[model samples]
Target: MMDFPLKPVDHRVLLPVMMILNGVSLATAINLVVSLDPEDKITSKRGSALTLLGFIYFMSLSEILNMTALYTGLGHRYRNKFRLNSGDVLDITNKFVSAVQAAFSCVTGAIVCLWSCTRDFMRTSHYMSEAYAWFGAAYFFYDIWSMYIVHLKMYSKRRPFKNGSTLLSSGDGASVKKPDTSFLAYCKHEPVILMHHLFIGGFGFLVIVYLRGDLGDCTFGFVYLMELSTPFVSARGILSRLKLKSSRLYLINGLLMLATFFVCRVISLPYVCYLYSKVIGSSYIDAVKSLPTGCKISISILLLPQLYWFYLMCSGALKMLLPSSAALSAGDAKRRS
Candidate 1:
């Protein structure tokens, strides 16, 4: 969608104007959808048609945002300001887009979660959740394509080739890429992420449209709120790619990332279970034990990966904040000497 190559005589004048114009339209559309009367729009027979409109609305917005970023000097100006190579610029561009998408998803998730929680945590249904599911599903499709572009570009860039090295060298001594950078390669390298996206976009979409039956919007809302931590993840990627790991902002963001991931992605699931326990007037342990086998398996599947990721995050944070073990041992040896 970002194919605009014609920069106006002075794009600085045009950029903000374009962004505001698009932003207003996007906001207006969201407000309209959010304000829909569930009885009139959702419970009615035309509910399906309205949601189709919602899906197209968001997909169009994604395209427009991409074009805005391309033509508004958003990505190009950043490249000029930072003096980063073109090879890394696309990654930065995608990160900017990813951050924006994550922000929107987080906001919509918050809206759904709040509205549903205030009613009833599990059984009560809300139009907001119903509406935003289309957008969330659209994003999963868009993001998968965006990420594949990143991987393709990264692997296509010149990589070093040495004797007994992973990379191969062209006959003229120029470096070449190792392994295929095809879609299959991307799928092979990222099975977990692929499954996660498919599970949410496919299975979650099933829940929203077919299986939910006006109940469990609260559960779906909680699922949407899982994106709460995603903006931090995107920011961390952008900062790391810019070689800003030692900066104060990076450290602060890392802290926030870990905290948000723990709260939004990890603890949020258990919190839902606790809420369920309270709803059923049962003890937490008993409530958990009372869950169906399928439910227990699903929760475990989600929670285990989160726990593993949290451990890795903590390890990375310690490695960044504290002295390395090698450095500590060297210091102790010097003192002894």
Candidate 2:
């Protein structure tokens, strides 16, 4: 949906534009922090402000680091993981930026989850902590959109995945390879990511407006779970870039990712369903009925996608755990013969 315009452009334009957008995002974050009212009752006051500031600052720093790494290849020194040749600079940078964003998001989410669970556990309906979550979501919306656009442009060029071949290269000369696939195949895989961003962005906006930065602690808890698997996801990317996917570390990280996704996203869905139902049953009019149509829809829409994503996660976990299933079957057939 975001790629409506298929016009061609010089790849040279992308780098500067991306940098400017990142700068704009940084400016927006600073503005929000500067405009924050210390005496505001809608927030946890100093705590919320500090959290928001930290998140924004970290995000800005990530953006700057991404720009510098992409432009100057400064990231190559970080164990020399990335391969930034003339042919794949933009694509590689996009992946690097996303990995960084995901890592930071995971950290921020962990902090929010801990803070909310510990300090404001009892306050489940209306309180100030929601603001912090909302603020983070707002930043995430822009971040997702920006990356989506960059990748969309980068993926615009067609490739032949069907005729693709993989080679084994070793020693210090090893480099990461981009997947060989048509734009359509890329499109097919990307919607889930784009949709996730869209939903979260919309949900965040609604939370800011109708909920007024207060979903109580309970609802906010489930929402925060969305980021629980992010660090593992990011780690997998970093490891892949470093060409460690076949190592024990990659396997361990993959296992952790699977477990975290199951615990955070899969298990939390049913629990949230139960909790939301209970809330509606307790005060139907005040909680459910009073909500705007969009807000109600946003909350309801979160469950189905999450359930589907969990199913995908489970399928992936099975495949990862049983990576030699085909080989085992072949061995069994040979023995029988």
Candidate 3:
């Protein structure tokens, strides 16, 4: 009999779940994008909304890639079991390549951010507006590159058969050795870790976008800084799991809540800023009105890299958190039996 049953509720189940989430996010983004009033020059409110919507789109796309990766990764693990001809070796290779590409894209994003910041700083106040425009453009290009890399990785992992036979083949001309399916089984039952990471990464990217002035007019750099701290918070949870201790889970949860608070606050800052500026004086209103329509286009263009990063982090977090519960339970039952 097969040692590891091919259960229906394996990692494969996550694909549809992620797909549904992606659909929802996509719809939200499209709605937000369509709602923009063309008559109004792009204000901070519009820019912020666009940035959030763009990030949502990026998240959706990343989740799709992540689902594909998880499917292939789990499939490779399964093939390793029962000495079957698992065509997952290539998939694994593709995933690694994808990781490398993602890293490169991140580096590129960082560079672009630095360059824009530098240019803006060098320019006088007269050029401040133009500087912001340039930064937005840079961000957009960076995001496109990052998104393309993600798509490439997902596409590369599609063909599993080629890798399964060539790389996963056992040396003895027998089927490959089965892996301890328990690992994947364990993953399904404990998906919180993944979710936490996703939230942090997604929020972190938003913070970065906000920093680049691509999101809104609010100078909420502090909030962005707070959101950026999420990875460290999640790292604590990972450490707890590795050490087999639940002592830090509460602390991690606290941090997650704090991060969520910041995310919401930061997202809402545009409206807050608008209200504040309106109350301050007509000067602010005139200044906002003076911004060219191209500024909005620039911000949208530049915010893409940050959006991609946010999506990557969110997708990675989800992958880490949600494990295949059925697979885990089956393994446990088999071991106990």
Best by TM-score: 1
Every model's TM-score: 0.78, 0.58, 0.26
Candidate models: Cα lDDT each? 0.69, 0.55, 0.40
Arrange candidates, best TM-score first: 1, 2, 3
Candidates 1 and 3, the one with greater lDDT: 1
Local error of candidate 3 at residue 81 (angstroms): 22
**Model 3: lowest-lDDT 10 consecutive positions:** 122-131
lDDT of 1: 0.69
Which lDDT tens digits does candidate 3 get at residues 48-158? 554554444444444455445334666446444523231232233223333432333333334333433333321212212222232223333334334334333433433
Tens-digit per-residue lDDT, 1-337, candidate 1: 3333555653556545555655665565565576566422244344444444444544455455444445455755766666655446656666666666667667767776777778766666667665666555666666677678767766655554465335667889996666777788899998777777777777776667676565656766676777777788878888988889899999999999999999988999899889889999999999999998867887787677778878988998988888678588899999999
Clashes of each: 0, 3, 18
Error of 3 at 41 (Å): 19
Query: Which of the two candidates, 1 or 2, achieves a greater lDDT against the reference?
Result: 1
lDDT of 2 by residue, 152-219 (tens): 55544534345564443355778446554454555566777767776665656455435644344544
List candidate 2 segments past 4 Å from native: 1-63, 73-130, 149-189, 211-215, 273-300, 330-337
